[model samples]
Each structure stands twice: as C-alpha cells, then as structure tokens.
Target: MIKSGETNSRSFPGITISTDLVITGGGLSGVCCAITAARQGMKVVLVQDRPVLGGNSSSEVRLWILGATSHMGNNNRWAREGGLVDEILVENTWRNPEGNPVIFDMVLLDKVKKEPNITLLLNTAVYAVEKKDAATIRSLKAFCSQNQKEYILTAPLFCDASGDGVVGFLSGAAFRMGAESRDEFDEKFAPSATYGELLGHTLYFYSKDTGKPVTFIPPEFALKDITKIPRFKTFNAKDFGCRLWWVEYGGRLDTVHDTEEIKWELWKVIYGVWDYIKNSGNFPEADTLTLEWVGAIPGKRESRRFEGDYIMRQQDIIEQRTHEDAVAFGGWSVDLHPADGVFSEKPGCNQWHSKGIYQVPYRSLYSRNISNLFLAGRIISASHVAFASTRVMATAAYVSQAVGVAAAICKEERLLPADIIHEGYIGALQQRLLKTGQYIPGLVLEDKQDLVQLATIAASSELVLTGFPGKPLLKPLTLSVAQMLPLPEGAVAPVVFHAEATADTTLQLELRISSKPGNYTPDVTLATRTIPLHPGRNCITLQFDAVLEKAGYAFITFIKNPLVALHFTEKRVTGILSVFNSVNKAVSNYGKQTPPEDIGMEAFEFWCPQRRPEGHNIDLKYQQGIRLFQAESIRNGTDRPAGQPNAWVADWNDPQPALTLTWQQPQLISYIDLVMDTDFDHPMESVLMSHPESVMPFCIRHYRIKDAAGNVLAEKRNNYQTHNRLEFATPVTTDTLIIEVEHPSEQVPAALFAVRCY
Candidate 1:
C-alpha cells in the first residue's frame, strides 16, 4: 500500500502510487487510451474528473457517439474509425439500441474495468504536476471529490486526453488557444485574422409526455425574451435531447475559464425554450409534455490545443494528404461552427468536405516542449480549422487508441514518444494497429512476421462467381435505372441477379461496360436479356461472354416495370457501383437529417431519391436479410468497413473450402491470428432498429488446421468467434499449413479476412 505523503512533501497530503503510464481525463479518448495500454500489459492509472467515463457521451452531457463515419451520411464511403471505437460501437449497438446515454456510460466503464492492469480513479481531477526535468513530467497530483482523498501518481509516461488539455497546461507545455490567422498555417478555412473565439459549448435536455396535461413553471434565472434568439424560430418543443445541439453558447468568450458563466447562460436559454414550449399557445402538443432531464454541465468543443512536432492544418484535411507516419485517419468534414453559435444569423456552421478520408500523423500527438507528455483528443496539435473536423468524440477515441498503442511500444522499448517517430518504429506500430483491427487507409498490413505473406496461397476455389444471392433492395426502384457491378479484370463467369415481382411481369435487363476507367456511366450495351419474373424471389441469370479488359464497372440497367422489384444491398462492395437515372426532383431523406453536402452532390443526382450509390454486389440474404457472402475479404485484415461489405466468399456448392499456405522453407511459428467475416447488414446506429443476433450466421462455425504431412495440429469445432487467435504451446515447424473451413449448416460459404502467423 502507498503511504500518505511518501513521494511528495507533507504539504501535499495524498496516497503515492507508481505506475508505468498515467492518463488524465475519463472521456472516450482517455478511456480507450487507458484500456489499450492496460490490455498491452502496461500498468495504467486513469484519472477522470467526472464520475462517468464518457465525457460528452456521458449522461451528464448526453452526446451521441459519432466518428469518421459521420452517421454513415458522408461520401467518405466505407470509412469508419476502427479498433476500440468499433468495439464500443458494435457492443453498444447490440446492447442498447435506444441510444441511452446511461447505458453508454456503463459500456465504457465496463471496457476499462475489464482491463486487469488499469486502475480507474473516478471523480479525480488532476490539479498539480511535478516535472522530472525541463522535458519530462514526473508525477501528478489529483484530488477525488467523491472520496475526499488525494492521489500522487508517478509514471514514466503521461498522456493528456483531457478535452481542455489541463495536464499539458499545468506541466508548462507549449500550447495554443483559440483560432489562428489564415496566414499562419496557410489554411484557407482559417479565419481571416486571429481570434480568441471558439466553437462554443452545448447543453441538452430530454422531455417526455406525462399522459395528462403538464404545467411548467419558469425559474427566476430563465431568459424572459425568447425573441432575442435567432434560432428560436427553428425550435420545436417536440424535438428534445441531442436534437437540440444548436442550443449552444459561449463561443465568443473563453470556453474553459468562462464555463460557469456559459452554463448559466445556457440554463437560461434552455429554461426559456422549455417555458415557451409549455406556456406559449403556439405549441398545443406540448401541453402533456414535461422536461425529463436537463444537463447541468456543458459539452465543450474547443479550448487549449497543445503544440506538437507537427501542427495539422486545414490544407491537410482538404487535400486528403497521406503521411508516412500516419497512425490514425479522420473522415469528418471541415465542420466549422460560427463564433456566435445559436445567436448567429447564418446557418449553425459551414462544412467543407474532402474527396475522401485524411491521415493523421504521429508527430501531432506529442507535446513539442514536454517530451514525455503525449496528447490525444482535442488537445492534439492542430489549427482551429483542422480541429473542427477532428474534435468529434469518435475521432478523439481513435486518436487515443493510437496513442495508447504507441505508448505501450514506447514503454516496452524504453523510448520516449518522439523516439517512436524518429527511430523507425512507426511501421511496427502501424502493423500492430492493423492486427488489432484499426483501419489506416492506404496502409496495408505487410508485417514481415506474418508467415502467410511469405507463402504461396492456394484455395479450394479460386474463381469467385459474382451475383449470387444478390443484395436485397430495401427500397425497390421503378424507374429505368442501371446498377454498376465491378468485375475483376479477368472474368470467368456470368452475372446473375435475384428479383421479385408483385405480379407476373416482363423486364428488360441490359449490361453495359464502361467506356473509360473510373467511369460508372454506361457507354455501350454489351448484352441484353428479357426475362419474366415470378411473384416471389427468382434468380435471373445473364450469360454474357465478355472479358473485362481492365478493372472497371458493369452497368446493369433494368427497364421500368411497375410489377418488377430489383434487389440490392445497402452494404457497399469495394468495386461494385450503383447509379440511377431519375427525373424526380423529390429530395431523398436517406435516414440522415442533413443532405450529403458537397460530398454526395453528384452521386446524389445519379442515385437521387435513394441517395445510396449503386455498386453493391447482388447477393440475397438469409431469411431475415442477413448477408452471406463478401468478396475480396481475405488478406484485407479488416472484416467490416462501416456500411460496406468486405469479406471473401466461396461458391455455395463448394462444401469444404480449403485455404492453403505453402512457404518456400519450413518456418518456426508459435502463434496464428485469424479473422472471419461477420455480416455487416446490421446497422451500427440502431436506436430505432434492433438486430436479433450480433454474430452473423455466415461466419465459419468449424475449422481445422493441419501440416504438410496431414497431421492434425489444432482444430476448433462449433466455433462462433469472428476473431480467433491460436497459440501453440510449442513451435511448429512446417513448410505448408492448411486451413480447412467448414460452413455452418445454413449452407453459407465460409469467409475469412486475415491469416497471420508469428
């Protein structure tokens, strides 16, 4: 046990504890950071000021968990923040579909608590720090308001994930506050001149109907005149909780120091808004509604951003620049809110999107002045314009995961945060991250330690026939539209699609190949087929003897037939393309409240009314719309990519598919990691929708591994895990390893993503 005032002077009364890593803040980023480090065998001490784990996502503040996927509304197709963030999302989606903030807090708390090496201190605020030298933080002093006790935590490495970067500030680390001038970083999105204004803070409230008429009495602190607020016109009393994100304030003042003042102002606005809803004769529907909950603490957006080796700028996000030392990626648009926030006359914010997702380098995650101080979340080095995109809770969680993994490597090698970037350790770090399911765009997992990469791969079935059990079109299209299906350069089989009809109908299907590369529009009709469809599902086969000269899209257009309903999958396929030619000017409300912005400007016009791009392979799902096959899934190292399908599938007739890895020479290996495809049909955001099962039925249920001599090395029967790691008690030396996969009794083909050995 740590004795009181042992490490520090008697003036500082606290229990002194030593750990390898010390993390401040219990937000999503901090929680993920501590969990990642602890899981990697590092002793972690997590100090969170709030009792709950999630900061903005906590019930205290009540913000939904959003990341790079942007609710799957943006054009950063198939982009989702992976690793720990994905884990939390998947778990939360399965456990709490209501999107309850209290359940989300438990999910985060449970994840951190499961790590044996993590010591979580809740309601503990880090107020003081001791410096080992000019460049290193030696220890931190925190006081837990809940327990009325103090703690002195000494660590070799320190991570400041605090939204306000309190640790870095107290440690005298170089930092910047507020916006920078456009000339400073050459950022076009930056303000014309420097300003101290920030993105402001938000307070949310939840309301419910009380069955009978409910009366609301206004508090004395509430604002009297609601007409002063410009956004008051958009206010609908029926919209409660997070839907009122525009109920924000304090961007014109200091976001951190002036938090109390901001909170008071926000309270006045919230109460006034509620009063208008209850007392105003305009809202008759609110007569039976009562305020269920209102947040006291405001969810802050920006404050003190620390200075690091590399300062991310708006150009990097706009250009979608790739960095050599990229450890994480962000796909959210350059979402910059006006300084006036709710009071602004203009729209709440202006968003500029990139062509695709952008990379975040390791150089921007460590303090420039304080060598041992690693930064995560909003504290990372970035100009205000760049921070606008990376400030979301999900993006911050990804950043923290990277920092946690990097910190583990640093502790293992006894190196500082900067050494990982300069000493050529980034490649290893990236590889490790990939193995853990973190998707870094453009960075393929090519670990030299992976024995499968050294081997010549052969499968029981090499030819992947397209258009089997085609994706079901949730919303059938009646207009004469074409769907683009990506065919591999070398073609071996014809495409088939399954469709249904309300009545006996005849439809004409035309297959058109692209005239130019990267173009999905049909240029010339290669083949045409006129077929009659039945009432229920029927497989329509089109036999076209044509070899795709290059990797391009095949546009399949179906003539308008009111009785015929074509099938398609919401899950996007890597090379599949979908487009529709419709003159209907009716706007599409494809689940998202806002339009696709500039990201989907063109694609929206092509596939308007439905909004989703056409290109997903035509594959029929199981009884309840469960996807069964994924192409190009093997060797990708990731099973799912947001709403995209990413697993390889075999011909359903191929009962026992064997994936063989034959190396040139016999190698000693002790560990193997295997990842399989779980259906991506289930939506991650299932607040209004719920899925029956978390694991897809198409997952491999049974598998066995054997050596060249046909000796059974290891086997798993009746397995349901998507990710399986096998560790041999003793090293196995073999030139050839065979992994024979058995499909479940459901008749689905086996799908695998990665076969890694170490």
Candidate 2:
C-alpha cells in the first residue's frame, strides 16, 4: 500500500452497476421481490440500508412476520401466502422453530446468497434518484458507509419496497402520508383525527428468567414513573419482545423525519417499564427476571404510501371485492393504531376483521404517473383504510412477489409497469404467478402445455373418508370447537359424537358454513341442535335436516360446556381438521370481533385451528362416506384446499401408495412440479413461536418417480416445501409416469395437491 497525495476535495470510490431490476429495501418485501425476480432470470440489485436483511423481521427490530391466517387468529383457513415467501417461512420453521431472531437472519441471508442472479448490497443507503423523463426513473445514487464507496444503480424497472419509500419519494411519485378523510373514498372506517392518522414505530425488549436472583438499574434517561403510560399496568416482567407490541410512539410527529426522536421516546418507555417491573415493589417474582436484549432501532408501520392507478378503499376489503388483475391477497384485519401510541388513553389499536381475504389488484402495485416505478410493502398504492390491512409483512411480500414476476415480463416484453395492465397482459401475469405457487384469490393455474392434463391418471387408492377412528384422548369442552368437513351438494350427513359429561349439561350444536362460497367464515347457521347429556360416556347423534345448496367446508360446532368432554382422534387427513372459537389477542382475535355500528365492520365468530401437536381432529363418524378425494385431482390445476380439498389423499390402509399416469404415446418429459401439502392453514410465524413439527405431517417426505420401464427417475428423502420442482439433466421419453410416496407418519396420509409433468 502506498500513501496517497491528498487533494483539496476527494470523493469516495464510485462504481456504476446496471441490473434488470433495482429493489430498494432489504426487508421481507424487498428480499422476496429480489429472489422472485432473480429466479425468473433477471439481474437484480437489492439495496438495503441496514446491516442485515428482513426490515422489521430482521434481528435489529425482531418483529415476527404475519399476514393472512393472521397468527391463525382470523377465519382465513388455508390462507397462507404462497410462492417464495412461503418457502422462506417454511424454511425458517424447520431451521429456527424456537424463533431465534438471529437464526431467522441466517435463513434470509442464506436464501439471498443462494440466488446467483441477485446482487445484495448491505448497509447501502439510497439517498438520491435520477429521472430518465418526468414520468420515469433513470437511476439511483446510493452510498455504502462501511465500504466507503458510492454506487450508481441503473435499471429499466425500479421497485420501492423501502419502508419509507425513498425511491418513490425521490422520483416524485404521487404519495399520501396521512390518513384520508372519511368522505374522500367513502371509507367509513377511516381513523378520526383524535383516534390517529398514522400507525407508529415500535421497539421491543427481550427478557429472561435466571435460576439465580438478578437485578436491573435504570439508566439516567430511563422513565422513572411508568404511570405516564396509560397502559402501564399491562407491562410485566413475564411478557417481552413482540408480546409487548403495543409499546409504540412517533405517530403524532413526522414519522419519516422524526424517527430518531420517536426512538428515544420508545426507549424511554421500554426502560421505564423495565424499571417499574424490577424496582417497583409490585412483585417479588421479578427478582429473577433480566433484560436479555433490547432493540436498537424501531419497527415502522406507516410512512408515505405511493399512488398507483387504483387506490383500494374500505369497501374493497370488507366486501371482498374481486379484481380482474388480482395478483395477490391480504386477509389481515383493517388494523389502525392511535397517534398517541403507548401514551394513548384509548386501546392500542382499533382492528376490524373482514369475512375473508381480499385481493390486491395489479393496478394498485405500480405508480400511476411514473411509468417504470413499481410499489411494494407499506408504500403500495392503498388508501389509509386499505393500507391498514395490506401493510402487514407477509401480505407485503406476497404483493412484491407479483411485482417481481411482472418485472420479468416487463423486461422481456419491452414494456413499462402499467403496460401489462393496459395491454391486456394481466391474465398472463396472473397465470405466470400461479405457476410459481403464488395464490391469487379465485385464480387457478391453467397451463395448456402441461403433459399430465392429457394423461390418464389413476391411483392405487383414494381416501374415502367415513370418519376418523376415535383415540382415547378426552378433551373437555371448555371452549367452543368444531369439526370442519367438506360435504357434497345434497343432504347433510349424520355425525355421531362420542362424549362424556361429568355433570348433567346441555350440549348446543350448530351446523354452520360461510355466507359465500370458497370462504370459511362459518357465518351462516344452517341448523342448530341442543342435546341433553347424562353423567357418563354417551353416543350423541347430530342429524341436521339442512340441505346444501352447494358443496363447501361445513362446521359442526359444539358450544362450550365445561361439564362435557369429547373424544379427539390422532388420525390426520390432508383436507380435514378442527377449529376452535378461540381468542388470540396478539393478532386481534377476541373470540368475536364486535365493532360499533357505523365502523363498517361486522361482528363475526373466529373459527381458528390449533397448532400442531394440539389440533387433533374431533372423532366423528359419518353415516355416508365422503368420496371427494379422487386420483384425478392431481391434474385439476389448483394447489391448495379451496371449496374442496383440491388434493388427492391416499387411503390410510394403503401400504404402497402410488399414482400412475399413462399416455397413449411416448412424450419427452424433462420438468416436473409437485405441489405438496404443507398445512397451508397453519401460519408458520417467522419468530416468537415454536412449531410442533419441522416438516408438515401431511407432506409426502419420501417419494420416487419412475417410468413405465420401471427405471427410477428421481427419489427424494426429505421434501418439505409445498412446491417441489425438478428439472432433469436430459429429457426422457416415457409412455407412463409413476409416483410413489411415503407418509410422514401413520396419522397423516400422503397427499398431493397438484403434479404437473412437462
């Protein structure tokens, strides 16, 4: 090394990089977008301001990612966001089921690192943007402090997944920072000025209990009197991290510019609460509790949301409106917080749940005036009311995945972001996304090029479910529980429930289904029965006189009666599971969401399933066996459970479960895509929760593919992802294809959602 002659003025070393797509943000939205685009054959540059990936979900902030199936706290059954986001979450569970935030960082970093087409620049902040025209972005100027270098990133397409929407803001894209008035969009659920115009930044602290006594002393700036917080009594040494999510601030100030001030205030609140719990003589049990870790930065909820062609409003979410260009879905409630944040005299949030998941149209994902700019995450084109729901991490990632796929098409078609919609290529965009396991509500994969659609599909055995044989486990009816089963479009089947009552009690049972088809709300009650129980084990027959208008998942609900205990079975089927009328306040589930009359939200019961190792199917015998699981379901084009199971589940008794597809003539087959069952109903939370199993029991872990010549093509030992894609090194001409699968356990049968060979 040689000493340099210092000049009057010097600049950092500069480099110019060109990529197909420039994703500004390293959060889940940006990460998923980058991965999706890179996988689709685009050179992607992912710029992040932080040291690590996963904006709010990263270890710096440590907020667990959640979307539809809102913590399994809503009625969105089988509603997990699919595609690369699902892959990331499923992998996180397998690697870090214990919810170590640092482990989660490893998962994201590892995924991005694996993508060869991606260029990830960590600690790179994009401060300035260059415009090609008044309506397009030309390039972005970013600086990396750690490397002491400057980067000029140029791309045809630009995506603003940045939480603060730096690119969108700098590019002069139309954006709204504050809440819209109720009369503007006719959004009745719009937040009143006193309620709050914006959701604020949140910080979290982790605590641990030592076997020996421990103590904590507050810093000089630490809040001495926790009484300043309205909800001071709610804070305890036992709850930390995301469990203390309500501890927020900075809504009243400029969220973008005053973030540092907000961080200080949040720090003041966190330390104050810790001081109150440790030093206040409230409880001697706090002697062993210690602050393990505290977040240095804050997790932001709202900033400047960019504008696109269509601004989704209140009715769009609550009414579950459909869009022709629907590319993604969001089911999280229309959740809004107060401006006063932690110091508010009101409840922390005024959350309102929809009856079902709402679609995010392609029209709302791109800048309306800016021709080449695409929006993602908290900055997407949505009204203040709609953003409350779509602002969630999983949903944001799902929306960005659509953007990624769209960007690939844009680059290939020589088009801008809005051209796909105006040129009537939205269907192509949706179909392409569906091929990659992205779930667009009401959309099904219809690939004419798939070879399996032409083959004569036949399975050795299909599940003809009569009912699960009862196990010895007796669960008390302390909470309302239901057995969810898909029925035919005919008379309701009679079910026999084996239960015992310690004391005499009346068991009230109701048969309910969603008001709309393809929805699992259980809002419409078809019939009700009140049965008297004796003080011993008894067989109760619930014969509903209801006739179905259409086939859908029906709920057999047993109202909570503490005196009665029902038998539950260990037998797990792919499409069948049980739901409980539960309350998980973490995601705003309160048994039932009851809102004021004019708030635009209806009161609906939450029928959610318990996590694995706990969600045993209720043992109920059906007089007529349900024969919906057929071998032909493999080529049906749908991946997950819809109005029907949309999957082919093998019979439990079948020792060698296999499916064979025969073609009249030999065909060249080189690629295979199999959609495995991963318990889509179960929300694989990124952190703060422990999953019962690493791999979904319903997934076919061990599987082999063979040709008619009896030569094995491929064999997988431990498959966990929902979408298993295999591309052979060479094409094989085969007249028939055979798929043999092994169940993970005796309880769960091997099931395949869709298998496509081309």
Best by TM-score: 2
- Expressed as tens digits, the lDDT of each residue in 643-704 for candidate 2 is 88999998888999999999999999999999999989888888887788888888889899
- The local distance difference test score of each candidate is 0.73, 0.91
Kindly report which residue stretches of model 1 are placed more than 4 angstroms away from their true locations once superposed.
1-13, 192-196, 454-463, 470-486, 489-633, 636-646, 654-671, 678-722, 726-749
Residue 284 Cα positional deviation in candidate 2, in Å, after optimal superposition: 2.6
- Least accurate stretch of 10 residues (summed lDDT) in model 2? 464-473
Instruction: Tell me the deviation in Å of residue 630 in model 1.
Output: 10
Candidate 2 off by > 4 Å:
470-472, 503-505
Error of 2 at 457 (Å): 0.6
Report the lDDT tens digits of candidate 1 across residue range 349-405.
666555457889989999998999999998899999899888988888898899999
Give each model a TM-score. Answer: 0.80, 0.98
Error of 1 at 236 (Å): 2.3
lDDT at 194 for candidate 1? 30
Leading candidate by lDDT: 2
